[model samples]
Target: MTTVQPTVVSAEAVDVATRGGAGTARRRPRGSRPFRSPQAQELWGWTFVAVPMLLFLTFVIIPVVMAVVLSFTDYAVIGDPEWVGVENYRRILDDPIFWLALRNTVIYTVMFVPLGVLVALGTALLLNRSSRVVNLFRTLFYIPVVASTVATATIWYWLLNPQSGLFNIVLGWFGIDGPAWLYDSKWAMTAIVLMSVWSGFGTNMLIYLGGLQGIPRELYEAVRIDGANAWQSLRHITLPGLSRTTFLISTLLIIGAFQVFDQAYLLTKGGPGNSTLTVVYYIYNQGFGGLKMGYASALSFVLFLIIAVFSILNFRLTSRRQS
Candidate 1:
């Protein structure tokens, strides 16, 4: 065999061959860089959210737990809480005022939700047309939404005045006698419903406007090509399009209707003989006015359950329509 020549490796060849090799990687400087791991990232996340979590635990979780515990006892804020079993609940069953309040709230919700949805939808439809004037009117409608609830209630108090309010004056022009709204038990709840609708419809109008805008123009065009009338298009396209929005608005209105207090408190003080006393007003009276915190907590849970039931029912009903 011929003698094998020993290969001469040049400096450039050695440098190119050794570049990014394991030995060079080992020799590279780390420069004070810390190694990161999933556990470290997770720890950092928890650290960042620690304060907010603590506050949530302290304020929301703790209070809800305490309310549940307190509902089974009589803690009138004057002495040690004594266990009362379901006696408070039984009292609620027998309490005429509770039933009356529930009825009034139910009636208010029944009257308010449909009217609110219709008025909001109508106004939104009217405002949805492309024009500067429509935009201006949209802003005007939403102005009441930003106004303070207390201030709006005060304004309604003046507006609902039987003798001198603009409402009766308008009725007077029609040659009809307007009844005493706040002073009459029969009209007190109705008056609250009207005021509630007026002050709050602006928010629902915006929601409806958003829903209306989301409807694809193709659907309307298709319906139009099919020779569908305005009512048919509304029934098949517009209403169906706004079904979910209606559900959301209805749920909110129901919850709010059951919890109505500020307007009733300011307008009639739950009077005309307790016609406007809602469940929330009842809870307020017990919790603060009468110092019956435990009973109030029980009432609160009951009201919560009622709202929950209604909200669930509304969701189911609206889901069917949407489907």
Candidate 2:
């Protein structure tokens, strides 16, 4: 009788613990489906990813494929596409205007990249402080980036006026005559370069600020304790630390410089003997203006090649220097 009572009491205790006095959830059956299977989870993940993948395939991949196919054919949007094989590619070799546009683009890239980097770095260094005024100034500098390109170009148009522009007015203060910027071919490109540097450097400056913040303040303090002057500190600590940032900014600048169109289109309109005719502008003129879509596609691929080559070279050079 005692043995049976003890067994019964133990069974009751085990039952109560298993029930957890109604505060605990009931254990699910072994075959219950409260959670998804691995395959179901995987399918849901793919369902979400498929949306963007579908859009990319429909827009980007399809258009690129179509462009490649169309580059070998003559299509003017109205007429049926006629196959021309390598004729368009061959014609590019003899296209003088294309060559001129390429040369002009090269010149713009050369002038803009270094100047843009310097301006952005300088502005970032100036604004790399913690104060209300400095924050306000940073916002002010970034205003140009948020402003519409057309609006910025319009503002610059008035500023670059030959006779009564703000630029010439400022030059008059020093008794130096400012050249007719947009009107004169010699100065037209220079004007474009200046405007580009001003309008685009704001973004680069923000990027530099991010990089600057990432750099350890301890290094600066260490250098100061070692009797390093401002310039020396910048040369050793600041410059070396920002090498990656410089590489990124310069790469972006190079890409944008090569594909310059909006500023030249809005400001110069490729005027004054086509001096400011960039490759992208020429491509625009060819495709839409002249209705030579096939040729334009060919030119686009050529420009793609050029940009790729330059980008690779930049990466290699920057990597070598860093190493």
Candidate 3:
């Protein structure tokens, strides 16, 4: 009688406890639910995420939709947006300045991508050792990367200044005359590429540094045991170990180079016969400056398409190389 009564009491206790938790909750046959009301729990779950979800829909979703709709129209931010079908897109094909901007962008990307990767890789290789001095140098290198685009451009503007600038002064010390960087059309883009590489390589350097950590130390020891020199070890192991990192940095560099805007706008202003008029800068000029928002939107999409194609190509090439 006592055993049976204990079992009955225990069962009743568990039932009571389950029902008491989470007000208005139902008792389950087997498992105890943490909350009483499923709907109430669901409501609170949604409440927590409601703000971010609303923001995403409002800003990202709505703007993308508006841009797509506007791309098909001739809205100058004035009267009602006039629907022009594919005329805006068709006009882009015949626009001479569009081609020029694209050519300049391509040139910038070609120069910037390889140089950016090499600088980042070289710096990472140089600084990957475990030492306080290495850490300090790494921090110093990364400082420029975190600086705002405007700030970096302003500093470079002064550094690359003609006649009185630091670059010309240094060149003069070597009995070499530095070309007018900011004013010379032929050299302006080159100067921009150099500045970009210096300013941006630090980020990829960090990425490469992290990738270095993932490489096994025994690999280096194995190479050393085989009488491998520094150059051989680097060529065979270090570069191979960083293939994935290189691919990622290369992809990012391509995207960023294509979107080159702030530097050109702040330092060069697409001057010297529009030598630095990048695709994004051209889009900005047409969209906001000239109030041809619709055409600019179309240009923006074209740029998006170009970036997408290049990104896909990069992925395929890397994958093929790996395979």
Counting clashing residue pairs in each candidate, in order, gives: 0, 0, 1
Computed on alpha carbons, the lDDT of every model, listed in order, comes to 0.89, 0.91, 0.91
Q: What's the TM-score of every candidate structure?
A: 0.88, 0.88, 0.86
Error of 2 at 213 (Å): 0.9
What lDDT tens digits, residue by residue, belong to model 2 across residues 1-323? 88789989778657757777453234444553546699888998999999999999999999999889889999898889999999999999999999999999999999999999999999999999888899899999988888777998999999989888999999999999999999999999999999988888899999999999999999999999999999999999998889999999999988888999999999999977999999999999989999999999999999989988998898898788776
Candidate 2 TM-score versus the reference = 0.88
- lDDT at 103 for candidate 2? 95
User: In candidate 3, which residue pairs get closer than 3 Å at backbone N, Cα or C atoms, i.e. clash?
Assistant: 25-36
Clashes of 3: 1
Q: Comparing candidate 2 with candidate 3, which one achieves the higher TM-score?
A: 2
Q: Give lDDT tens digits, candidate 3, residues 1-323.
A: 88789999788768777667653255445554545588877988999999999999999999899889899999999898999999999999999999999999999999999899989999999998998899889999999889888898999999998888999999999999999998999999999999999888898999999999999999999999999999999888887887898789989988888999988998899977999999999999999899999999999999999999999998898777665
Which whole-number lDDT from 0 to 100 does residue 83 have in model 2? 98
Measured over all alpha carbons after superposition, the RMSD of each candidate to the real structure, in angstroms, is: 11.2, 9.5, 7.7
